[model samples]
Target: KWTWSAVFTLQWLGLSIAWLDGAEVLYTYYYPTHIVLVGVTVSLIWRYYGR
Candidate 1:
């Protein structure tokens, strides 16, 4: 969870920076996919490690 939080924080920061720089279209378009992929990856990792 902590690791995911950190990754998410950095992701948001980077997205904001890029958005301000005018790359809003790409990020907005892929945001959902990006989030889903991250969530799945983290959950899989956590499950594996937890075992």
Candidate 2:
């Protein structure tokens, strides 16, 4: 739920950016960066929110 909303927002943002810019940015930066960010965010959520 928590990460869902954040990730969802990022999904749209990334989509918009990719649509506005081009495939270069989407593949070069957005893919790697978004993957790392999602990993980190999920890790943090697990570390702090887990029982």
Candidate 3:
């Protein structure tokens, strides 16, 4: 439920940005900054929960 709420919040933020600027939805690089953020989040979860 919490992850669903987080996804909803991210969607709302993305939509707000896209509404303000059509270019906000565009991904300009093969290696985007958000990918790094995702990697860090995954690594943290793995560090805490991995066997």
Candidate 4:
């Protein structure tokens, strides 16, 4: 179940980043912020469970 949840979380995060990037036609920082957040989330999850 945790693996499924992790995959779902990753997909949702990717979709979120895509949405933010798509929405930020002017304030381009939004894309980078979303990417950073997604990176941090993935890294944290990996750090905790990647062993």
Candidate 5:
């Protein structure tokens, strides 16, 4: 869980830095990756804590 949290945090941080650095071209690619990560994170949390 912490591993995923760290990954999610780092992913956002990298995305923010890239956007601030004028890397808009990467946004298209990052969007889908971000969505998938979010989905996985949510499912993992539900599966772990929904007991």
Candidate 6:
């Protein structure tokens, strides 16, 4: 849905900006990023199959 897509896109853009700003070591963002990724995946699956 739009909410999930927006969350994913915003997170991706934030990460990309951070990396471009010389934040080569993004160790702190791994857990949050994984959480967002999993959330998006689960949201898609539930939307389609949990009907």
The model with the greatest TM-score is 2
lDDT of 3 by residue, 1-51 (tens): 575466457656665665566654535422254466457767876887796
Between prediction 3 and prediction 6, which has the larger lDDT? 6
At residue 21, what lDDT does model 6 achieve?
64
Separately for all candidates shown, the number of backbone clashes (residues 3 or more apart, or on different chains) is 0, 0, 0, 0, 0, 0
lDDT of 1 by residue, 1-51 (tens): 786787778778767766776767547654765687688877989898999
What lDDT tens digits, residue by residue, belong to model 6 across residues 1-30?
Answer: 786787678778867766766555355664
Total backbone collisions, model 5? 0
Error of 2 at 41 (Å): 1.0
How well does candidate 5 score on lDDT at residue 26? Answer: 56
Q: Alpha-carbon error at 34 in model 5, in Å? A: 0.5
Q: Which residues of candidate 2, in runs, are more than 4 Å off?
A: 1-4
Model 3 residue pairs with clashes: none
lDDT of 2 by residue, 1-51 (tens): 766897889878997898789988889878897888888888988988896
lDDT scores of the candidates, listed in order: 0.73, 0.85, 0.58, 0.67, 0.77, 0.72
lDDT of 5 by residue, 1-51 (tens): 687779779788869876876757457667778788788888988998899
Kindly indicate the candidate among 2 and 6 with the higher lDDT: 2
Model 6: lDDT to the true structure: 0.72
Off by over 4 Å in 3: 1-15, 29-31
Q: What is the lDDT, from 0 to 100, of the residue 42 in candidate 2?
A: 82
Cα lDDT, model 1, residue 5: 86
Q: Candidate 1: deviation at residue 3, Å?
A: 0.2
Worst 10 residues of 4 by lDDT: 25-34
Instruction: List ranges where model 4 is wrong by over 4 Å.
Output: 1-27
